[model samples]
Target: MVDYHLHEAIKEAGLDLTKEQMVVLKKLHDEDGLNQNELAYLTYRDKSSLARLLSKMEKKKFIVRKPSASDKRVNQVFVTSYGKEIFESAKPFVGKLIKRMEHAISETEKQQIISILKKVQTNLS
Candidate 1:
């Protein structure tokens, strides 16, 4: 599956990150200072599960969670300098994987796939 290929690509690129971690890292990098709730929602993870994942990422120094200035109960997540470095390191491999996938499919096929996926999502919702 695509996920398996992506995991291999990341490992072959010498990055010690999982696809889940990369996803979270990219999200945080794209929108720094997102609170835990926002990150959980964006990542499609429940609160407790996201917390555990964040805990591991925090231990890896990929991210830092700070108490919100406005609300003490909320924790804002930010990518550290090291996190940015890791994300930058993984970008090329991800890009290559994307290129390979795109090369394998025509634009029309890609659109059809997307449309079908959207309909599936609608049905699920």
Candidate 2:
């Protein structure tokens, strides 16, 4: 339901990105220079699947993969100018969604929820 809401919001806001693609873009925006393997782990995707996704994103000109200076074999991913523009444009919509989702929750409640979710994630890991 949350994903659907976010997808509709992005579309309504005139952004051309699927939720999955947005996840990749957002991650790259937050932390550039992540290699394909690191991105796969961070995004909870398999390496092969991420490679395919990266290929599509490259064709769209949303990202560029350059050979890492430290390791020639590693490809570091970075968002392009177009990708940054799209991410900036979608920021308001993302903020709106977050605000709506947290509407009824107090700060304390929000912290508690975060704590619980972290514990759950740790348990799973």
Candidate 3:
């Protein structure tokens, strides 16, 4: 419930996001250093979208692309110093949202609920 609301609340809070941009940001937030394809798969975004967002983010000085020494064809995404600062600033808001989620249930209940949701996901698969 809270997870569902969180995205909407984020939008309501005047945080701007193109669909792909949000996914890219969230994916990077979770798992850094992913290649373009890997990042797209993880975020369920298309390559075209990633390309555009990457371009925009690069221009904004939020992220950098470094060529992989092992694979010349790929560039790993790394957050820049400014991106780190932005992420740090957003952490408190995320923390508050998490706290609100925790308030609605006990730790055990939260675990159980997440387990159930995961099971449902697996069951669908």
In model 1, residue pairs whose N, Cα or C atoms come closer than 3 Å (at least 3 residues apart or on different chains), thus clashing, are none
**lDDT measured at residue 39 in model 2 versus the true structure, 0 to 100:** 99
Please, what are the lDDT tens digits per residue for candidate 2 over residues 1-125?
Answer: 99999998899889878788889999998898799989999998999999999998889888999999999999999999998888888889989999999998999999999999999999998
State the lDDT at 91 in candidate 1.
Answer: 95
Q: What ranges in model 3 sit over 4 Å off?
A: 1-31
Alpha-carbon RMSD of each model: 1.1, 1.2, 3.4
Write candidate 1's Cα lDDT for 56-82 as tens digits: 999999999999999999999999999
lDDT of 1: 0.94
On lDDT, the leading prediction is: 1
Using Cα atoms with residue i matched to residue i, what is each candidate's TM-score against the true structure? Answer: 0.94, 0.92, 0.70
Sort the predicted structures by TM-score, highest score first: 1, 2, 3
Maximum-TM-score candidate: 1
Model 1 poorest ten-residue lDDT run: 98-107
Backbone clashes counted, model 2: 0
Clashing pairs in model 3?
A: none
